[model samples]
Target: MTTGPGAGTTVELVKLTKAYGATVAVNAIDLRIAAGSYCCLLGPSGCGKTSTLRMIAGHEDVSTGDLLIGDRVVNDEPPAARGTAMMFQSYALFPHLDCVDNVAFSLKMKGVPVEERRRKAREMLDLVDMGKYAARLPAQLSGGQQQRVALARALITRPGVLLLDEPLSALDPFLRDRMREELKRLHRELGITFIHVTHSQTEAMALADLVVVMNQGRIEQAGPPRELFNRPHTAFVARFIGGHNVIRSADGLRAVRADRVQLGGGDLRTDGTVRALEYHGTSVHLSLDVAGADDFAVIVDEARFYDAPLAIGAPVQIGWNHADAHPLAS
Candidate 1:
């Protein structure tokens, strides 16, 4: 991959840490994000995902360790000097300024001519599909439109890396999904590294090429979403990433995808009482209470499940193949 200015740059954190006196926000962590890759720092609040992203954006001080963008160490550099742009969860568009002006604010700070900056701003708005709203203020536009303007503002700088701190958390579910596609398309077109910090596992699974799962200020696991979902390294990862049922088997702790757990098939068998059944449009989620396991779940196809539906508290037999079980660390 190419390195340096204007190109997607490799981001490396060597034992990076952040602390507030005795309290450590981010434990010493090592991560190397490939150039032009979409990487997501995923974890619940207080897991230090935001702190790590802020440190990379040069918005926060690194308590210790090296912060490298491309081949250059950028620990002490200012935010603007780090070749990174940050988009906050709030979108932070200038309410008073029109969309075009909001996007051109960065260039205006650099003393660019009004006509030239506005022209550049319009181009950015066009890229984000917000050109038609360029003349409107933040209040006049919708939530998604405001977000697009914010994105255009961040991109106007043409940085090597884009650091987003929960960019879609503020949008409605439908808008969030639409914006996700927009973000992915933008990343492909721009070919720049995108380091997004989000707590939503669904978002990470949908968007990230690499997902870094953090817990208690440290990385629990880091890999492709499928690897983390299919083969979790630890119990925390299995539970945090969702969709899987972690259980203590005779052999050891293992995790099976809810979809993989069969209601009444395969050689391996176990008996459980139907604790709850949820009817989703495409699939049915069944919560079961096995003899030894806590709350086991199986995702059944909507049509198949309805064909022979079981009632709550109904005794049911469940089975899964040995190959479907993925062992987990305690």
Candidate 2:
């Protein structure tokens, strides 16, 4: 009923584990990344996102568990031998090689003839809309261009799994958005599995067909973007992904979403004073102080805000149906 990135078989992680002596880099976990799927390992820094990605790419040795590439175990294979191409966070483009040569580096290493490698690289560059910049060196290209070259280089190898480590973190907002669309298009065109790692919630929401939520070396939740947003499984996820106020209930035993409360209700339901209202073009965010409950905020339409505005001194009542509140039990 839902989908995110690519379409194919599946990439299964069977009890994957990675540890650095006493420090657990990745706890025992199981995951199945759908084939041709664009899955992002999303979490804060030090959560072992890169470690999990590296294990899949064979950059880091697995402590235990099986990694299956389309139903075949790949735990013992080398990165290249495992049929995966990794685009590192640093871009990792060769400084001396021009864009074309850099993009063709892998093919050339694989014994692809000069002419064939050059032609393929040029085709890839054109696919990335960087054909005109083929002759430019890494120093000559902008940051975004360099990143694209890194991507093209990875794709030139035609590997089964494409491992992207925070690929868009360096680009500005505009370029990041454009590149997100480009990545989606490339995934559609190539039909290869994409496993991306990113800490940015916006990027994960925009780019992932499936999101693998990680924290402190463990998976928190994994699901489609909409499902994760609309029905987060834990308090950490609710607060981390944004756009929702997790409020503690009156008895201090539960947290509820602020937007779930009906503003036109008989009382806005427990007495609270308006603290502040932050207005965006389309919506107004209300900061409230509810007695007997933790502080919270609610989002209302800008039109609604204007039609019935509440001042800072105004007392408000807010409550939602029990069924509308999701219990964060994870």
Candidate 3:
């Protein structure tokens, strides 16, 4: 509970897989999460991200391959023995117990003395800024406060690797943003590896030092957030990451960031009819009906957009510099 760094163990998966009867929820996939780094498993629903996390946590059996934590292969280890802790989407705090008792429950099961467990619990609550709510039941706290309690509980055992499954999905937008800051701070202070699973591209970009994009139980790309954004390897990654538009050209398929596309005046030019426009505070998001591209879009600066605002259904020429277009794998 002290404010210094905690040593985090490295996690690696080699051909890890999970199957339920004939359905392979997680196909053979390999990944390495560095010690003390924040990694996010990103994809749409049923992409095997949750299954992958569960396998690492030892909650689900790996159908094949090895799971290594630091130097040991722990494919047969129990959840409590895996040196990992999972914070579920529901918060999952015990409704009948007060905050302190909820956090101390694991220690109690381990046969730690009552006073000692309570002391450690208080320290964890203090770590999460929930010390003042130690005596309150879970039902009495707000959604955000309950989340803090759950976080404290997960950290009470001093896990080397923390696994989160959509931990922010239940909160409101404001609280989600605030909690994102708190999670980042905790990762910095604790210096522990965090493997978080989420379908939100924005959330992954905001928190992950490494982003792993999954589709159909396979990794499409895994790299630093900026690398994946600036140079996505495939059309799926470009489309799923939200801001990039995939276009088919004479040479092959390519991707261009929406902000880099201009209404006119660039090396590559195309004509499209504006289909939709959305105001997003600092920029305008415009969807266009281009011939070969589905969901073709562009982002224009607020000041520039207002200067020559194009109404929906207006025909306009859109283009991007040749340097901005990144080729994608077929």
> Any residue pairs clashing in model 1, and if so which?
none
lDDT for model 2, please. 0.83
Candidate numbers sorted by lDDT from highest down: 3, 1, 2
lDDT of 1 at 198: 96
Best by lDDT: 3
Candidate 2, residues 1-330: lDDT per residue as tens digits? Answer: 012224343678888999999999889888988788889999999898999999998899999988888767989987777778899998999999999999999888889999999999999899888999999999998888998889899887777788999999899899999899989889888788899999998999998899989999999999999898888888788777876656565433344555666675632256678989888888888888876545577877889778988898798766667666766764
Q: Name the Cα RMSD for model 3.
A: 1.7
> Model 2, which residues run further than 4 Å from truth?
1-9, 250-255, 264-268, 291-295
TM-score of the candidate numbered 3? 0.97
Which window of 10 residues has the lowest lDDT sum in candidate 1? Answer: 1-10
Model 3 bad stretches (over 4 Å): 1-4
Select the stronger candidate by TM-score from 1 and 2: 1
* TM-scores, all models, native as reference: 0.95, 0.92, 0.97
- Predicted structure 2, TM vs. truth: 0.92
Index of the highest-TM-score prediction? 3
> Across residues 1-330, which tens digit of lDDT does each residue of candidate 3 receive?
112357887999999999999988888999999988999999999999999999999989999999998789999999888888889889889999999999999999999999999999999999999999999999999999999999999888788899999989999999999999999999999888899999999999999999999998989999999999999999999999989999999989999999999998689999999999999999999999999998898999999999998999999999999999999999
Worst 10 residues of 3 by lDDT: 1-10
Candidates' RMSD to native: 2.0, 3.6, 1.7
Error of 2 at 96 (Å): 0.8
